[model samples]
Each structure stands twice: as structure tokens, then as C-alpha cells.
Target: MNLLKRFAVPVACAITALAMTACSSSKDERRTPTPLTQFKPAINVERIWKADVGKAGRYLFSPIAVGDAVFAAGAGGTVAKIDGKTGKVVWRTRLHTDLTAGVGSDGTLTAVGATRGGVYVLDSNGKLLWKSNVAGEVVSPPLIGNGLVVVRTIDGQISAFGAETGELKWVYHNRAEPLNLRVSAGMTFAADAAVLAGFPGGGLAAINLKTGDDYWQAPVSFPKGVTEMERINDVTGAPALVGAETCAVTFQGRVGCFDANTGRPIWQKPFSSTSGVAQDNSTVVAPDDWSVITAFGADDGRQLWRNDKLKNRSLSVPLLFGPSVVLGDYQGYVHFLSRDDGSFVARVKTDGSAITAAPVLAGDTLVVQTSGGDLFGFRPR
Candidate 1:
């Protein structure tokens, strides 16, 4: 599947080929990916280590870093823990069932979801603790914190299970949209005791991590078009949580930030992205649907800079590193751009495969997982 195009279909056809057929029919009208150009290195990027979990067949699997240990899983039901500094495998476990989303850990308990609505929880030493089930297929990594293993299925159902005993705790159902994007929309932990998640139809909800209560709900974007396909405005990725504000972006909608406590709109701008935004204290960076990376002022929502060199390259989510924005592309090339001006600073290559998940910072090292199941740890110097 072309990750650059928006594959909008009904929820009933979530894992079918209807969305793929629709996207392929318009292949001739798609824009070509921009070619890379040579540039002088502004920063030196060092490859710290590399490891392989397994291949991610049709789902996006993101590796999670707890402290100095990194947890990663693949669609072949293999999960492993690696040392962030030495890149040595600590332990590996196989579940026998095919996994759809995974690698969520809190340094003690690790969790992964299977394609058949099965949720597996493991201890730190790679021992299977317990197993549970959900209503729908889990396409996003489960939220592992607050003593709960929260899993969100593709059918708008959020279920929470006990991290230790795998007992059913609570469930929350989000309002479903007629047409939705077949992509992974993830969840994040806010400063408050709540979980911030984006849903179909551009709705953002903050739920209590313990009691499954709604903190607040706000609209990131509204559907506005004549046809169903044109009006598909599902939130694409995980909502980013800063100190007091949380921000999210929609597929065919806008990017906006809201107060983390009250869910009030702080600022918004007209933007469309297939991935989420990464923000620090001063800037919010995101890639548009065409893969043009842009930066916005975190306070007043002002456009700062735009880089069109990666258009249609199927870039992953942008990670705001110390002095650069790190991202991976379709050909397994990691590109480092200056956070101030959006210019290339350094580039590196990995196994030739598409990287769909965002890069995570494990301590000071940036770790990224490719669809071919290779994990690379890079440190910018």
C-alpha cells in the first residue's frame, strides 16, 4: 500500500482490499516523490547500534524505550528487549499468534496486541504474564501506564485491563464516523491523570486513565466536503502532549492545540497531515499530506518554515531532537533537518524499507523501526 495517499473506507472493510483498490485506481494522478540532493553536512550522525525483531507484515509497529532498555515487536509474534547503549538482546519471546500492534512498555510490564483481538502482557524478563481480549483489532500500541493496559481497537472501542492480572476493568466507546482512514491513530499520556487520544471525524478526547471517565472532548477539525471521501477528516497519529497544552493533526483537517486541563482551544491553523506533529517549548513541526514538512509557532500558531524537498516520499512522523528534526523516509533513509530553517543537515541509510512509525528518543539516542523489522539507533553529534 502507498502510505502517501489517504486510504479512506468504511469501518466494516477495515482489513480488506477495497481501500487499496481505490487508491491504486488513481495511481497515475499521484505525485512523484522528490529526489534527494547532495548537501554539506552540518551535523554528524552516528549509528549507535542495530537489531532486528521481525518483519511487520501489514501493520505499523513502533519500538518503545523505557530507560536504557528498548522494547520492540514484529508481526511475526516476536518481541524482544535490547540495551539502548550496547544494542545487545536481553531477552526475546514469541507468542505464536500474529501481532498487529505492539511494543508498549513501562520498564516493568510490556504489552502487545494481536490481530485476533488478543492482548498479551509480559513481564520485564520476557515471561508471558497473562492474556486478555478486546472487541476489535488493535492497530495501535496499547497505553501502558497508571497500572492499566489501555488498548484501542479500530472500531472505536477503548478497553482497559489490569496490567498484572489481565482482568477487565473498563471500556469506553467513541462515536464512530461513517468513513474513516485505515491508519493507526495512537494515544498519549497528558500531564493530568488522563489519556489523550484522537478519533475518527477529528475528535480529540481526554479520558481518565483510572476510571475511564471523560476529562474533556474537543474538535480538532470538522468534516467539510460534498462527497464522503472528501469529508474524511480522521486524526492520523498520536496527540502530542507538552507541559500544559496538547496538540493533534487530522488527515484532511486542521492542526490545533488545546489546554491540557480544560480542553479549550489555544490556537489553530489550516493544516492537513497524514501523521502527527512534534512540538517542544517553542515550535510544532509536522509533515503535510504531500510530505512537505512545516513548522508553526507553538504559542500563536504562526507559520515559521516549510521544506518541500520530501514531497510524496512517505516520510514518518517528525521527531524534534536537540538541534534537528529527525525523520525516516520510504527508502529507509534517515534525514536530519535543521529545526530552525528546515534544511538538510545529515542523512543515513538503513535496510531498504518504508519507515512508518515515528522515531523515539531513548535517553539521548534516537531509535527508529523500519517495516522490514530492522531497528537503528542514531546519535547526532
Candidate 2:
């Protein structure tokens, strides 16, 4: 699911009506995006590399970093392998099809999903291996592991294919809700053998990587509100895994941690987020629906600190890079906040377009893909 595209229409309408409130004598004022406040830069960030692929407007394909090459897929089905150090294009290929989500890989093989219910696979050299048709439109990237390519679709269907021959291994189906968020559910590997997934109805399940049999299925968040929209509890983003603790956040629900192997609750915390959770050694950080970044203790889910400086800015997911937590906003601004106290450390401007995808990290360099098709790499100076 691409939440930025899904929310852009209403956000634009609010922006257009802002001037009337600003000039009115009445006590009616609309809350717009908070203006970026000026501050001394605490850390020096430099743009070390940049590139342009096809337009990424309104699409949600995130770049994947593998080894020394970073594989990026654009919204228009252009895939490129760029060198991590020099930002040189090693190989580029066009699928001749519109892509919905993709750029997932297992080093030697890569896969992307099409808008027309198909998935395209490519080898390391950018050669097309095989294309397989599935039952539903895939909004999330495929998870490649254990010689299988596993993909989850918008219709709550999960399928596995043989990585080498594109053979269909097995498929699992779950009952979907009538009203759910228009975002995607990312899949992760538990112990490198079990396929872990968070569903649109706030259900978490684990399946066998090879057999596709059900290992375990449990509800992470239950619908609680009275209205249907308020009760929408989709797990939109990817779940974070640290050691054996797997943490996930729900859109209108709670954030909790579960044991990866047994699905037992370690700690359950009341928090709402469309973005997923990111963790370091001691803290787990997440952005709530109002763009407030909050930090909690990883061990006990204790509240550490909260930063509301970027409220209403429509923030992307927080990324923990080195000593700072980085986030991108709707106005194409990259912000750096201290991991210790949730204080602003630095900020930089991009192409002035919304950053629809999460910021990706490759070694010491930070990479961000914007909706305006600008791919940038930054490093702390």
C-alpha cells in the first residue's frame, strides 16, 4: 500500500483552503504543515551520489541494497544496478510493464510486481529469468529466501515460487476485511525458514518457507473503534526484527513485540502508527499518525522520549543510521534527530517532492528515493 498517494488528495484540498483562513477575521484557522524552524546544524551531511531513474510519482518501490550493488526499481518498471561507492550504473533493464512494488532480492535473484497481477524475475546481470502470473495485484515486494520467491498480494493471498524455475510451490489464503487501509504488508523471514507476515486485518502468521503450511497465526491488533474507518487496523509497514523479538505497529491500533518463534507477547504498548518500527540496541522508535516520533525501551516497552516538532508533516518511517534517527517528510526534507533524546540534529532539502518510500541505508551512506524520481545518497561529513 502507498499511503502517500492514498492521502494526497485530501491533503491537497486542505492546502488550497489554507489562504482563506489565513486572511479571515474569524477565529477559524486550519492547521497546515509546520514551518521548518531554523537551527544550527549539529551534524554535517553531504550529498555524495545522485541518480535519476524513471518517475516514482505515487508509487512505492523501495531500493534494495545487496553486497556492493544497490538495486533500484522505478514506478515505470526501470530497474538499475548501481555501484554503492561510485553510484555508477552497472546494468539497467526495462520490463516494458508498469510496476506497482518491487526491488526485493536474495543477492543473485531479484523480483518486482506488476500492476496487472504478475511478477517479473531477473538474475544478477539484469537478464529476465521468468515472469509468473498470480491471483491478485501485489502491492508489497516479494521476499526471496530458501530457494523460494514469496509474495503477498493486496487480496490477502500469499504465494511461493521456485526461485530457479518459477514453479509454483504453494499458496495460502486468509479472509480479508471489507474496510482496510490501502497500504501494503511487508514480509520477513523468521529464523531463515519460517515466513512471517502481518496481514491487513491485524493478523500475524508464520508459514513454512518450503511447504507453505501454516505454522502459526495470531492477532496482533484487534478492531476496537465503533466506525469502520476508525476500526481499520492494517499493519502497513515492515516488521522489525532484533534478535528474537519481532515488533510491529498498526495504523489505528497498537504496537507490540512478539517472540519470533512462538508468537508469544513480550510486551504490548498502546501506540498508533502507519509507519513501522525501527530499533537500535536499547530503543525502538516509531512515527505516529500525527508525525510525532516516539522512542520506547526495547526491553520493556517503556516510554523514553517523544518529538512532535514535525507534526502534520506526513513523515516517512524512521531509519536508525549510526548515532542518529533519520526521517523524510512530505516536502522532501530529510531530518536527523538524535537517537538518545529525540532532538533535532540536522536537516537537508531534496527535490521538493514527497518522499513516499522509507530512507534506505547502505553501509555509511544514506539513500532516499523520492516521488519526483530523484535517488540520492548522503553521508555525514
Best by TM-score: 1
What value of lDDT does candidate 1 attain over all alpha carbons?
0.83
- In the range 1-381, model 1's lDDT, one tens digit per residue, is 111122111004353212422234357445567789999999998998999999999888989888888899999999999888878999999998999998789898999999779999999799999998898889889888778898998866799888889988899889877777667788887632777899888899888777888878899999999987778788878888777777899977899888777778999888888767888878889998778999999898898999999877877888888889988887899999998899999999989998888888778788999999999988878
RMSD of 1: 6.4
Candidate 1 has what TM-score? 0.93
Which tens-of-lDDT digit does each residue in 1-381 have in candidate 2? 111121111000001111222223245333356678888889999988888777764556677776667778888889888777778888889999998887788778989998868899999899999999888878777888788888888766899999989999999888767666545568777644677788777887777776888777777888887876667777767777766667788877788877666777878787777667786557788888767899999888999899989876777878888789999987889999998898888998889877756787766678887777777888888
Tell me how candidate 2 scores on lDDT: 0.76
**TM-scores, in order shown?**
0.93, 0.90
Worst 10 residues of 2 by lDDT: 8-17
